[model samples]
Target chain A: MIRSVFFVSDGTGITAETLGHTLLTQFEQVSFQQMSLPFVNTDDKVEWAVQRINRAAESDGVKPLVFSTLIDSQLRTHLVKCNGVVFDFFETFTGAMEKELGVTAQRVAGRSHGMGNVRAYSERIDALHYAIQNDDGATTRDYPMADVVVMGVSRAGKTPTCMYLALTYGVRAANYPLADDDFERGSLPAVLEPYRHKLFGLTVDPERLHQIRKERRRDSRYASMEQCLMEVRAVERLFKRERIPFFNITQRSIEEISAQLMQQAGLTRRI
Target chain B: MIRSVFFVSDGTGITAETLGHTLLTQFEQVSFQQMSLPFVNTDDKVEWAVQRINRAAESDGVKPLVFSTLIDSQLRTHLVKCNGVVFDFFETFTGAMEKELGVTAQRVAGRSHGMGNVRAYSERIDALHYAIQNDDGATTRDYPMADVVVMGVSRAGKTPTCMYLALTYGVRAANYPLADDDFERGSLPAVLEPYRHKLFGLTVDPERLHQIRKERRRDSRYASMEQCLMEVRAVERLFKRERIPFFNITQRSIEEISAQLMQQAGLTRRI
Candidate 1:
């Protein structure tokens, strides 16, 4: 069955969408047609959202599900009047939380994802730039400043992991791609020797690596099974010998990899 | 006063942290010492988390607040015995949702951020690579494949915005850095001429641009206030003259920018 669902928020709506997606994943039997209505802080926008929700309800022949993270109670009041089953996240929890914490909520809008702290925002941008500049071992001079350095063979999911770490946690992450030189030499790169403490490795299943590389360069030796197996074996051996922590990214998402890297590497989130 | 808060989950803990952070932001008067406990799927991990939460409650002289997205009910039963105010997200909403949808929740662990769908995961990675390859006008050969092309002067927040869009939504967002060449030409770049409908622009206040550029190249003409003003004005005029839709990202976060871009560009999330 297909149900209409909405993630409504006064801010970026990211939190609402994320939590709602998590909750909906438990119901694999039902398919959801999802929409996000963001920046719904005004009464007019609330009315507009109500119209959309009511229309969805009418067309779908069932009440649409509205997962709301709207912090403004007045706006949320307007939202609940719609012909939908509302799961008001903030309203559900904030009342109990206020009594427990013995403090009143500020009820301000857009504070979650807005540029509320300029310094933290700038640091996040700086971390992203660092990841870009230091990608693929472009420069090791700044390795001392890196919170973590990720190493993996080509297509082993290094770049995306580093970028996710930097953007999500404000952690300065640099990545290096291990190639024939490192595998043939049978040792850690000379430049990475000094920063072994911050080093983390990633390896993928050989077949998976081959599949990934084949997409980039079809019918090439680089995408051959022999090449993929050899590189993965060498990288895993190096990681074990050097006592560097590593993860197998063959079955993991970038979010999972980044989070595990932070915990295993003992790297604190800068933001 | 300082309060301890924990975001606990059976998966990456990202959704729990996101929703918990959003709720915490409403209480500006309280300072939160926050921690995330991820991948707590087993009974052993549940016990470990209980010990940690209890310790925090004992040390802080106040009961900690636990925001949990644990999908497994038995694990959550053990968690609530800790000396903390537990806010179980799934427990709070799932029963109601089950009744509304007339289906039982699967109660599967780690489905939210797991690699449940391989095609979706690969598409997200491909989108990230597309953003990296097409960044800063590196190549325009693949412009036709992009959902949107973001343009802005240096430090006006194009690269990061594009990267965020790609990573978060699987949207192929390419960015071109507007430079002296585009301004001198007094028109869109020749490569971008055919893709006017797919174009979006980003602009920042000249003073903000000066500050951002100054951090990168101090005491250089590139960072000069005069240069910043000239570039911003020229690019904005080009946007106005060409009727290219644009946003001033001086006050918006990357999440906000990406969401607004998706709305304005009519880009649908692929994942």
Candidate 2:
């Protein structure tokens, strides 16, 4: 049985630790641990980690499973003497991104985590996720309670992102829908008008929306490819006319999107 | 075979979707999907959920496996007609808590996840699992970018709780030893001094600490009952003179401790 697991990251160990903790919840028997060597992008940290692993092997007889997000291979080699298994997140993701984006990611500048600001994107994305899943009509009552609200059409990943916000930030998030009918009428949804400043928008390509919707409703008009295209164009136009600041969520993971919004919204880096 | 799974809490479909998506990250073949009924909490939402489940069953021609968390039993029965196995967390936990705490729980709260604040707690503890396993010092500069340090004798759950804080709040946490030698010195390890306000103390009864420590290190003076009492006494006196707000993490899980600490420190929640 796995007694322990470690999460390592090349940058901040933030993503690795979060995902690691999440995975550990499924099992009750194992203990979880984390250590981040932020500049693990360096040879020094890698050698240091390997030395620690060597010492652990000498004393702590237990085998530990290491999950890492190091973008460098040399550091991983340093940990070779550690008496356990090692896993990397940036390793797999870089390969995937290289294949998909058709280019290697340039070493980022001065640690953005792909971000320039903190709370703005954090708070907004959190609010957006909150809005998408506000099923109890709770969003209506949540206005005063809300730090932000996100509005958009179907399959825009409103709910999941919002929940991430609420779960992560303790920010009360409320999302509103800009349905086909509402779009046709050409204005923000009635529920959203009163909270315009708090109302953020999410947009995605129609192709993506249709593909997601198709998984649920096979032949329905809402799920059809052509209709999805029409909806996207309509929603995009509506958001533009309304001057709502929106994001194209095609390339971003839920994390990146929320992070970006938090930066945009001026929320501090509580992350 | 299970094609997909749904993990939901209360009326928000988005929160369930966030969990479902994260769970999906752990698997390669299962099709992870999500649905929500955010406005319907109390008894009404349960029946509505059952109707939706039934409809999904008809469309998929498979009994959908639902990991749901609806607190109302009357509504849970409605889901029984759906041709799938439904797992409700509250259904299990409420009974367990009622038995353990000797009281009934009222009001279904956020995401209605049976984990609730424990959800945050689990996330933190899980991070600790990763920390020990990985152990590269550079983690200090990573996403958690933790500067605050926690120090106490072992088995006080310093590792797990730090991971929880790091992953949950993005606090880069580092812990140092407060062993006999350090105690004799009557001062914190030199490295922890620069981050004093960020320094939070975690102190528990030595007897309890000894019992827990014994599981990891057998028969050592550090793990003996008498020694534990001495250390506990010394640390309490040290903390009082030095003035560190600490919690006795004797009986509580990492989550309970984390919740108290987060509230105490006035730290903002991290998604």
Candidate number with greatest lDDT: 1
Model 2, residue B218: displacement in angstroms? 48
DockQ of each model vs. true complex = 0.89, 0.02
The deviation in Å at residue A118 for candidate 2 is 22
Question: lDDT of all the models against the reference?
Answer: 0.92, 0.56
Scoring only the A-chain of each prediction against the true A-chain gives TM-scores of 0.98, 0.55
lDDT by residue for model 2 (A175-257), tens: 66667787679877677777777767788888878876886688999899888888788888888898888888774544445
lDDT of 2 at B174: 68
Residue-wise C-alpha lDDT for candidate 1, range A86-202, written one tens digit per residue: 999998999999999999999999888998699889888999999999999999999999998999999888999989988889999999999999999999999899999899999
lDDT of 2: 0.56
For model 1, the stretches where C-alpha displacement exceeds 4 angstroms are none
